[model samples]
Target chain A: MTQVIDVYDPSDPRLDDFRDLNSIDRRPDLPSGKGLVIAEGVLVVQRMLASRFEPRGFLGTDRRLGELSDDLERTEAPFYRASAEVMADVIGFHLNRGVLAAAPRPPELSISQVIEGARTIAVLEGVNDHENLGSVFRNAAGLGVDTVVFGLGCADPLYRRAVRVSMGHALLVPYAWANSWPGDIELLRDNGFRVLAMTPNPEAQTLATAMEGLARDRVAILVGAEGPGLHARTMRASDVRVRIPMARGTDSLNVATAAALAFYERARR
Target chain B: MTQVIDVYDPSDPRLDDFRDLNSIDRRPDLPSGKGLVIAEGVLVVQRMLASRFEPRGFLGTDRRLGELSDDLERTEAPFYRASAEVMADVIGFHLNRGVLAAAPRPPELSISQVIEGARTIAVLEGVNDHENLGSVFRNAAGLGVDTVVFGLGCADPLYRRAVRVSMGHALLVPYAWANSWPGDIELLRDNGFRVLAMTPNPEAQTLATAMEGLARDRVAILVGAEGPGLHARTMRASDVRVRIPMARGTDSLNVATAAALAFYERARR
Candidate 1:
């Protein structure tokens, strides 16, 4: 069971991990300057507890501590209980979520390990926005996408904003960054996965038609940045190009939303 | 042509409509304490110009004024051009978008007018988040949803945040608030629309199957708040309860993303 520690000092050394959160994403001391994964709010905190990311410590109000008591029973981390004002002072701002969990970044999984037995996976390229990256994980988790593979130019899914926007699915969903660019996609193809690239081209097959045809085979749905879309090389590497059949004159849907539509179509069949 | 007035003074009264935008959403004199609809950045500003909301005036950097030169050719509104620092001083913050347009709230449209000739509409209940509301509008427009109807507990669609997040689709797509609660749902049914309520119930029909069955009929997709979902009374009033097939042990998708999947499926066939 976790120990509850009462903290009254706003500048306590033990609370360093939670300080100045707005800039915490940059940690030069760390290898990549990416800070530890931070999860905010009670629901997200609970999700963190359940995921593979082990919590280093927790800083939250007594109310949230009480709410998280059941979930914290299995963890050995200390919970720093502080008044809302003291907690806000430590974090450098008022947080309405009232609870938080910090977890060290774990070594990333290999693409082979993530796609070993995966039937449906999402491959993202140039999806650099944190919120969109987070939403992709949430959509993947909810829509039964077995894995998420980050290709070139993707944001850190463990970033605080991404974790929060993902509703902590960034921790729950298995993801791996591509060690190689379009070459990693070839690995997916070799693993019996049919790569389906999502595009806005009207002439391409619709998501419904594409997914229906590939229902019996393992599938990898590839999506790219909203405005630029998939790189020509990436599109060339794919086995098939698929579109969501958007309304006329409407250019495209949000990247994550379009990805969700593709994921949903794959799951439904 | 728009009259370009170069203002060196930061305290110019002509810029009052675009002043202190961070708090401009709260207008005590307005019915809902919401201020005039605001459009920021170049694309959204152009969209606002093309929308039903007429810009009374604009405050922008000269660069943005030059970019908007073509769009301003048809308008007589004054462009209050200012330096970036002066623009920031008047807006009480850094205006990264470099431009803004303020339009007063027009008269509310009747529900009948919004739903008229609509084949697919989204009826929102208790979805009070401005960002989520905006995303729904953007998704609706991109996915071919004809109109939006707000039933109860919805935020003001014209709020500045909603306008910006909707990518200015809040101005393009038509929406109307229901004067009657669930009773307004009958109005849709009377117009030959099949109201499909979205839920997380495992027993409910999948969105794909449900939407496929209703492809030929007018459809109104009903969504509620993220946490509580549709009220029991509201769900009871719906014609069919449909659910997005989710992976086991996962929570529901974001309100806007879930709505997008449904809208995409409806348009897919």
Candidate 2:
């Protein structure tokens, strides 16, 4: 069972991990940084408990503690219960969610480990927007994409806003950053996965047609940044180029949305 | 030809319509609101010129003015040229978009007016989030959705954030607010549209099956708020209940993304 500590003061040293979260999350220390992974609200905290990232402690209102009590039973961490006002003073803002869980960042997973046994995966390059990254994870989870492999120029999926925007799927979904970019394409090919790059080139086959051809094979849906799209080297490295049929004069869909469409199409097969 | 008015002062009375944009957009004066529809950035400004929303004036740097000179030739509105710093001082923020165009809200189009000659439409209910609404517009534009019809509990599509998120497609794609909610659905039926309501229920026919049946017919893709889907009354009113085949243990896609998939399915035929 988890321990419950009733705390009255906002400035208590014990609450430091949960303090000024906005700044800490915005400019997270990196390169051997020991920044904590935070999950907000009852639902996400519950997910955090179930995820591989183990929480060291929790801070929440008595009501949230009650809501999370059954989940808390699975962890030995302490729940620092406090009032809404105290939480606001501690976090430097009013947190309507009323609960938070913080866990130490775990060791990064390897690309091979993430891709093992994955029949359908999403490979992302230059998707630097956090909200877009989060949405991609949420979409990947919902659409049955088995794994997410990041190439380069991607934001940290554990950023508070990414986590929040993804409805906490960033925690549940398995993902790994590539040690080497377009070179990593060889690893996927060696695993017998067809790396299909998503592009706006009209000459490219429609997503449905491409997926239909690859229905019986392992597939990787490759997506890039919003405006610049996939670098030419990465595009040439792909086994096939797929495009969502767009209306005349309209630009491509948001990268996350485009990724979702490809993921949806791949799952439909 | 459009006229050019050079202004060196940051507090020019002529710039009142574009002043303190963030605050003005946050708490929009509605109903009697003579507030203008703002188009930020050069591309959006060009779109606003082409849209029914007529700009009363323009604001931009000299560089942006040169870029937009060709598009501005069609408009009679005076281009209020100013430096980036002066533009920032007037707008209360550093808008990197570098240009803005403000147009008085045009009289709303009736449901019949927007639906005329349209083949595919999106009907939304209780989708109050501005970003979602904008994404719907952007997706609709890209996926060949012809019109958007709003049900009750929807936000203003012309809101600044919605316009920005839509990439100004909110201005290009025609949308209408229903005088009555589920009641307006009948209007669509009478217009020869096969109304297909999007639902998360596993029992609902998948989007592919439903779209296959309606390949040669006019269709309306109906969506509701994210968590609570289409109201039962509205669901009952739709001709076919359709759902994106989501993976097990997952909820629904973002309403806009769902709509895009439905639109893509429709256009694929």
lDDT of predicted model 1: 0.92
lDDT (10s digit) by residue, model 2, range B1-269: 67999989999999987999986564356563646789999888988888999999999999999999999999999999999999999999999999999888878999999999999999999999999999999999999999999999999999888998999999999999999879999999999999999998889899899999998899999999988988999999999998888876678678888888888889888
| lDDT over C-alpha atoms for residue B55 of model 2 | 95
Clashes of each: 0, 0
Q: In order, what fnat does every candidate score? A: 0.91, 0.73
Instruction: Note the chain A TM-score of all models in turn.
Output: 0.98, 0.97
- Residue pairs with backbone overlap in model 1: none
What digit string (tens of lDDT, one per residue) describes model 1 on residues B2-25?
998999898888888888888898
TM-score between model 2 and native: 0.98
Q: TM-score for each prediction?
A: 0.95, 0.98
Q: How well does candidate 1 reproduce the true complex, by DockQ? A: 0.83
